[model samples]
Target chain A: MRITELFDNGEFVVTAEVGPPKGISADHVVEEAKTYLSGITAVNVTDNQSSVMRMGSLPACVALKNAGLTPILQLTCRDRNRIALQSELLGAAMLGIDNILCLTGDHTKMGDHPGAKPVFDLDSVSLLHTACQLEKGVDLAGNPLVGEAPKFAKGAVVSPCSDSVDAQLAKMERKVMAGAEYFQTQAVFDSEKFIQFMEKAKQFGKPVQLGVIIPKSAGMAKFMNKNVAGVHVPQWMIDELAADKEKAKAGITGVELAAKVIKECRPYCQGLHIMALGWEAKVPELLKQAGI
Target chain B: MLITELKNKDTILSLVSGKVFIINCHGCKDIHFPEQEAEALQKELAAGGNVTGIFTTDYICNPENLKLRLGYHAEAIAQADMILVFSCGVGVQTVAAAYEDKKVCAACDTYALPGYQGVTPLEHDCKQCGECFLNLTGGICPLTACSKSLVNGQCGGAKDGKCEVDPDMECGWERIMRRLAQVGRLDALKCPVQVRNYATDDEVKSK
Candidate 1:
């Protein structure tokens, strides 16, 4: 079923992210994704997430869709220009990949290739607007389409942990106005803050999926806290994971914390987007532990 | 005016540890230039007899003007082991280019002061993020004015038109919408937001 259909049918939507491998082969990642195919509503394929040059999200999503799974292809403005963005949107639609998540993408300095020139030709808002234009059978320059317009279930990212909630909300409003049908927020650890965000986001009257990350270790939590913008892993969680001596037991604690967060936040959101980092296989266990 | 704070004391003293010549720029006319801070530090350095000479010049960003000042201080410039620049980045680059052999370094980080109108610094700042939305947003820049630098509408973080990040500041979008309402151009908000051409500035800079 289409992701939009799942949302419309009032199925508590579940989505998970798939980071394309650094190299070209998508076979292993696609095979790993199949294990949880029955659990998630859709799988999000990242576009060189963290500015690392990886296999393009398009082909990976195509691979998943070919394997009989719904795929949400992430498109970041950091890599492509408007022309490429519009062209790829149509291309993805042609290959039966409809869902798209627009992002401004992380700056190039955060990636493995810091020397690479950043091409933030468009921010997420403008990309959404362009997607809407393509949906209407026109190009960015208002040129008439030679063929049919692509149909896509457009989505965007929101950060509830933004230092400026007012500014972030204002940006979300613009995204909504431009053509974002849904939003998946950045990974949130603080339930109170996420709940507060939901209280305000509810006013937008759109389907929002809360982001939850499963950290493998205390070192991972601290690293994310320091490196990732808008991701806050509380000190107590860090302390709890740090207190555990065995790494395997710490992994279990991290999963439990993720499940606890999911249980607490599920009421406020329409769905959950589990970003396992690299631990995608354990999502079913997390779902079971959360009693979802 | 662009604000510039002096570099940390340790960094400045270390750079000025050897025979040093100071070049203070009056370029861009930033109201926040720390003349007192520079003077106090200079006095301390002179008390220890580390100072070789000090010179002040306007338009140090212009290499020709800096060259003239360098000519006047040739003796001290030749004697000094290091040239300490208490100016903006542009001035530091200028001094460094003039004397390629000397170890030239900045004593103050240069901040871009926006609202340039024939050399006057305005309170507003423009990040020049390739795409200009100033014509649409009532001349207030969302790139610099908004905390998140978000191009879309406001996030839920604003309360009573004040920014959630800094309550003292007005929300950029709120201000845009209010101004648009006043001008009866609220329809502009509904227009397709343009994709920013990040390459625009890079191309310009390269040229």
Candidate 2:
């Protein structure tokens, strides 16, 4: 089902992130998704996440769809120029891929190949505009397509936990205009801040999914707090994770913490976008623990 | 003004060999020239007897004037094995274009400057992106200042009022929000999404 239609049906949709491997085979990801992501709404295939080289999201999404799972193809502008971006969008459409999440992507400097030339010819907003153009049976140059044009249930990202949110709101407005049907925010750690963001964001009249990253360890939480943008690992969360570490140190250590955050934010958002990052097996347990 | 920061001394010195001709542009009305830094490097190179000579000029981006000044340094430049350019990217480019055969090394890295064109003393920069967003952003140019160059809005990477890309750099959107709030025009941001027109940039347009 299209992500937009899921929201329209008033479903509390849940999606989990899956990165394609560095090599060509999508077998591992497809197997992982089939095993654990059956309960989720869709599989979000990342496009070279963290600027690391990986199997393309287009192929992986196709693989997931063939495996009887929905896929949201994350399309970033970091690697491709405008020409490739437009071409890729059409290619995704031709492959029966409809859901897309447009992003600026992490800078190439953060990737494995820091020296690779970053091609951000179009930013996220412009890319969304370009996508909308393609859906209208034309490209960015106003040139007509060969036959039937592609349509997408487009998504964009936002950072709700930013110190300053006014600028984000302004940008979110632009994303909507540029054809963002839904928004999945950056990793959210503080629920109170997210609630406040939701108050303002609700006016847009679009479904927003809260981004979730389970704090695997206290050190990881601290690292995210220090390095990740719009993500603040409150002292309480860190302390709790550290306490969990003090215990058995096994079987989803962050489930309670994840559940707490999910329970708080679930009321405000339409869904959850859990970025499992190799911990796909834990997502179902987390959802159940959160009483979803 | 084009603000140029000195590259690592050891790295710059490695590229330089034999008797070198130093062309330093005390440019930008000398408002931001790292004169002391440049002089310190020159002293070290001279102590080793590798410096053949030193030539000082301003506004090296001005090609016609720079061509005339090049005549004065021709003898010294001819004797040197390498030419060390202590200026922004524009100055280095001008010198490099003038002397294609001569190996020219840039002693400094230019930061957040517009074309490195050596224009005014003003701190702000405009890349001439054609479509202006200054009105909505309270005079701050997201294209030039924001590390991500996100015209639509601020990214989620800023922390402690600093940019996600560079910790030392101030978050561009934070500055814009402050300015907008200060001017009592914060509501001006309730506008539409900004889609940058790549048509103005020929390089981008071709792609």
Candidate 3:
């Protein structure tokens, strides 16, 4: 089902971020999605996530689709040029992958293959525009597709916790104008800041699914704060995570923290995109504790 | 103008098998020359009697000026086994193409000078993405300013006004927002959706 239909029906959407395997088998992700993330609005399969070469997203998405699951096919501008990108989108559409997540993607410099060429053929906004054009039956060159036009519910990503809120809002307007039907924000840790961003971002009138990353431990929180862009783990949360010196129980505490934030941030967003970050089994527990 | 910096002297010497003629493009003079660095290397190389001749030229990217400048160096260039260029990539390519029969090498490596610059003045890079976002951005060029060249807006990665990719570099969009607010043109950030002209974007990505 398209996320728009979920929204139109007033469903509080929930999604999970899943990475395609480095090898060919999509069975692990498929099984994981089924066992732990059964109720998610859609399973998002990332494209060459973190610039590490992986099995293509479409294969994994197709596997999930074969299992009767709605999959958001993630497309990034890092590896593919416009031609490859559009062709991939068309392929996904033909394969019944209706949800599209368009991203400018992380630079190759940050990825496993720093030497790989970073082809940002189109930034996220332009890609969204192009996706809409394709859905409207015309490609970027204004040429019509020979077959039936593929339809998609194009989605964009945002960083509500960006240092420059005004600039972010400015971009939100562009994304919305570019035909971004929905948004999934970068991992957000600060609800106050997220609330502030949401207050202004409300003007764009698009469904924003806030990302809630579950930090497994104080060490993880600190690492995220220092390394991850757009993710700022607050001192209080770190202190709370650090209080669990037992470490074994800290993972549970981390789920509780994530759930707590999700509860607090619920009103500000149309959905919650949980990024368990390898702690997938705990997501079910986190949602349960959060009373979702 | 292009910024040029001298390459490692050891590497240059290793590449120097025979007589070498050098040309320095001072067109971007006073910007980021590494002139003293180049001269220091030259002084060391000249001590070996391997350097045939050396001269400085301006606007070596200009084909006509390049012809006039190289006209004088024709003899030295012929006498030398290799022609060493100290300029940006464009000037180096121009020299290599002009001297296809000669062994041409770049003695200096060019790095991006943040924002676009020209022959007349040194300003921030424009990227010339064809669809300028400056009018909507209070004259700040997001393509050059932002580390990712993300023109839509600032990414969430910046912290303490620093870029996510490079901690030392200030976040470009933060600067733009500050400037926009300073000029009371914050609304200008949304004047038009900054979709780069497809024709121009294709050209940029091809490189």
Residue lDDT tens for model 1, A1-292: 4566666777678899988998888898889899865567889999998889999999999889888788899998777877898889888888988899998776676679977877666778888888888889988768988777888899999989865565567677779988888889889888889999889988988888989998777888888765565678889888878777485354688788899898999899888888977788788988999888
Scored by TM against the true chain B, the candidates give 0.55, 0.55, 0.55
Could you list the CA RMSD of all candidates, in the order they appear?
A: 15.7, 14.6, 14.7
TM-score of chain A of each: 0.96, 0.98, 0.97
TM-score of 1: 0.66
Candidate 3, residue B56: the lDDT equals 88
Model 2 C-alpha lDDT per residue in residues B115-201, reported as the tens digit of each score: 445454334455545344554555556777787777666666678788866799998878767766764556656665565665644
Candidate 2 to truth, TM:
0.74
Please, what are the lDDT tens digits per residue for candidate 2 over residues A30-71? Answer: 999999998899989999999999889999999999999999
Q: What share of the true interface contacts does candidate 3 keep?
A: 0.61
Ranking by lDDT: 2, 3, 1
> Once superposed on the true structure, which residue ranges of model 1 sit more than 4 Å away at CA?
A247-250, B1-132, B135-192, B195-207
Question: Which residue window of length 10 is worst by lDDT in model 2 chain A?
Answer: A244-253
Model 3 residue runs over 4 Å out of place are A247-250, B1-123, B126-133, B197-207
C-alpha lDDT score of every prediction, in listed order: 0.75, 0.81, 0.77
C-alpha lDDT of residue A185 in model 2? 89
Per-model TM against the reference: 0.66, 0.74, 0.73
Better of 1 and 2 by TM-score: 2
